[model samples]
Target chain A: MNKDSISKMITIHGVNGISLLNSENEALLSNIKDQQISEAFVFLSSVMPDLEALLAMGAVKQVMLKGAGQQNLSTFAHKKNTLCIQSDPLLSATLLGQQIRSAIG
Target chain B: MKSILTNTISLKDDEDSYLFHEGECLEFSSTKEQADQLSEVALFFDQFFSALRDSDLLYTESHIEVDHALIIANILKNGHILLTITNTAPHAHSNLQHKRPIIQTPRSLVSNKTPSKPLDKKPTALSESAQLAIKKILINYLGPASTIIFNDVYSKWGALEQPTEKSRANLLKLLAEELYTQDEKIKFQAKAEVILKKY
Candidate 1:
């Protein structure tokens, strides 16, 4: 990957089966909105219990869980430098996007 | 008993206008008129009384000594009406003054279900996983931040003391403020207050 390309993009991995795309064409992680994550988990767990296993396979650079709820999984991601965005999903995404864009520019 | 019909009923400024009785809230809202018309006010009271009568809920009205009765009466005097009614009961009178209302109804008319008994002891059983998760979450999120100095915030918040409508409102308000924006917090608080007032 070229340095310019790397500088212009960031990938967000959403634990608990959420995904969203950013402007740089980089694969944004799970698009689940914050308020919907709990309800989403209820559905996802019924289908498959191991969401973390599924997320680990993706090229998500950072993991953002909704709310302070992420404190449960922070230890798991600490080794990977998988920055945990503490705000609710939407607020985290917006803030993350701004931070990423600023870093790239 | 000579039940004196006082012209002005003193009501606290912050007191809820409508009281809930059974499963219904006896409230009146005027649409076009700046205030309720005397006839409209009379009709509203009539409906409330009629509902109680229809339900065979025997109640008695007693004079209350309130400081703001004249003030509230003035508000009602100018075309506004006083809408008061009863609310659901587990079958016993509650110590909460706002929760209990006086009406001219027979005691037998009330529901037969015994009022919920107060718990004798505080809940001490906590799921091991839940306790661990709470501790971990607190240490990770709030402990490091140190923005708040709470020794046992969760434990304190989780406890219930004489669960009244006012207490419930306070709990909900605290939760909303912590989790939501100012507007959302206000909306949540308002919704809780509405529910508490009704039943």
Candidate 2:
């Protein structure tokens, strides 16, 4: 995705920031620079492959983490990269996942 | 707790489901036809919880939507992670399918009984009555797994030939650490202190 589309996504209500990280966990394109979020994404990326193989389910498409407050992080698999969306608590993670899937298609 | 799981199913209006804690199946209905699916999802959740715990994050809940179902994991009051799955039609909209589940089997089927050990070998410093009382209090905070965890901690605490006040306090500290938050730990310690005083 281009910078324009990525910028548009952040403007959506409840969306705070967006980042795209490659397999190596290096940010290919990221608007947010929080180290904790980056570290979480990297950890997720490292374990997701093994988790998929052990679970015997198809590749995991999306994961959403909700903190005790209004902080939420949702991750989606996009081609060879991972799209990490930081959003306010009101955003429906499932709906966000679906929207990203449709956009990528 | 069966009631908690039942309440969740009612609230979600969903299909057959099970609850898991640390990769172990804590409870499930007998009519479950999705054992394989549930097991795979549970294993995935075990790893997910571990990742979050290791990160020292403040996450209270998590969601993973894969294949045709949504798996939701919540951190329980006892600092344990519990996961439940809700089935949905493939490619369906965000609205979840609300099929009423079959009647759940009695929890007795799954067995919560702790294996009995020889009384002679057990620790006597902690009286039997006190042990039972402490276990009862734990049930409120730790739920069904209280018996197992209580028995485990009791073994160590009982090993002392003449338990000092400091050692007794240490035992309570260990149990309190199992609670989810500082507030919970404080509350549990207060209640536990009341019972231990008589012993």
Candidate 3:
């Protein structure tokens, strides 16, 4: 959806940062400031194109990554942009994944 | 702020692009069934350790298994791969009143009684069909670079050559074993093909 919906749909309580990257892995929208958090997303964003390429090639159905610690990242790749969420790890990534999926689908 | 050392997983290619990353919080799962749901942790580390060997990041191929999880940590350029397998289920330890047989990874499934034929050719690029099959299996977890990783592993195995039904079947089995997929159709197809070749 629009810029505001991202905040409306995806909860950012314990989330360190969020970056809405384009197919080029460039952040079209983000609120990451801490250098580590910023570096993390930047490093994470770099893989969006290949993800898109995978989707383009009719490969996987979905792409998600659970990082170490309490942080987890769910990437919803699209033709235009990739929604990457850096949030607290949850019991089931299904809920957060669905929210981001529907919000950006 | 305290850093949560929750189960972690990372996938970075030789080109230095991290396709998947989940490292932010410090909370542990409170459920048992959901414990094994760490797709992020499982997929990344499995490949990360495997990648080290392919990229020559490690002196030799290595892996670790504690309980149901596997870990492969390596010291690379900027960051070292730290893969730790933790059992989140409270019952994982308690419920195991009786001893269970150990599980083996495909890499460890090396058979001793040699093949019918002798070694002849070096590892080559995976056949197009095999690549296509593995791409479909690995793309979800690995993304587009699945092709690249596939090539690397294929060449390393020295499994590639004039494509024979036996070799193709053998390659597919190896892949199916390494990559975790929930889809039964894919699993069934792999098994069926392998059996057909054997028969």
Candidate 4:
């Protein structure tokens, strides 16, 4: 997707920030300024492979984390990269995932 | 020593659900085929979360959706984690279907071949329609995530006892407790009572 569409995806309602990270855990494009949040997501994505192996079930489609006093953090695999979104806790992760998939597709 | 809270939550008949505290398995039930994977995943999560906590970012809850399952982890009041795994793969449905033949067997043969139990002794099971009705009531209060929350709690409720009137009432009470405010719980309880009357 182009930069404009990527920018539009982050502007979705309830979204606080968004980041697109490559396999190296380097942010390729992002709107989130908090390096801590970005690193947290990147670290989470890094564990997906180990989690999947431990599960022996299938690939990790998405992971959502909610801190006590912070915005909800969600990460999902999209094509070759990972998309991390920080949003309001009330936002439906499943619906957000669907929208992301459709937007990228 | 910390007292573990395991009395309220019950694993379903299929035993696919589990509850873990700290790094220990407090409650777990699953088929033989899934036991290994579940245990492995549990250990991995314990280590992973510990590592995450050391990083100075504390998350109280996590939800992981895999291609074949949904894993949910929550930190309880006692500083223990409640990890629940639900199999959502298509093949899991096939395993569920295997149980259908037992229920679909000829009733006449079953009645004739086995000693009949007293009607009052048998617990009533919830019909599909009743479950759907309850779900609708929940959706009004909890919105889209209501479905996932319902399924998780409903499985536990079903495992507690046969879905009789009393059990159904308890299910509503437990679900109502999920609401944040006392007023919402009261309103939810009232709305749920209407469904109970119909069921």
Clashes of each: 24, 0, 10, 1
lDDT of 2 by residue, B1-199 (tens): 4355676555345544566554344556434334424444454554455445555656767777778767677767654445666656653434434345544533444466332221222355555445555655665666434545665676666664356654677778878877788987898888878888976
| Sequence-dependent TM-score of model 4 | 0.58
Cα displacement (Å) at residue A80, model 4: 2.7
Q: Give the best candidate by lDDT.
A: 4
For A1-105, candidate 1 gives per-residue lDDT tens digits of 234523333333332222222322122343335543323222212111112222122232332222222321110121222222323333433355455445445
Query: Candidate 4 clash total?
Result: 1
Candidate 2 interface RMSD after superposing interface residues: 8.1
Ordering by DockQ? 2, 4, 3, 1
> Which rank order by lDDT, best down to worst?
4, 2, 3, 1
Q: What is the C-alpha lDDT of each candidate?
A: 0.29, 0.63, 0.42, 0.64
| Model 2 stretches astray by more than 4 angstroms | B8-14, B30-44, B90-99, B102-107, B110-199
Over 4 Å off, model 4 = B1-15, B21-23, B77-79, B90-199
Candidate 3 segments whose C-alpha is farther than 4 A from its true place: A10-16, A48-63, B1-110, B113-199
lDDT of 1 by residue, B1-199 (tens): 4211222343332232332222122232211111222222233233322322233332122111111221111112222334431222233234335442232212223355333221212343332222222222222222221112111333355565553434554445444545326765565456545544543
State the displacement of the C-alpha of residue B100, model 1, in Å, after optimal TM-score superposition. 46
What DockQ, between 0 and 1, does each candidate earn?
A: 0.01, 0.28, 0.09, 0.27
Per-prediction share of native contacts kept: 0.00, 0.61, 0.00, 0.73
Clashes of 1: 24
Candidate 4 reaches a DockQ of 0.27
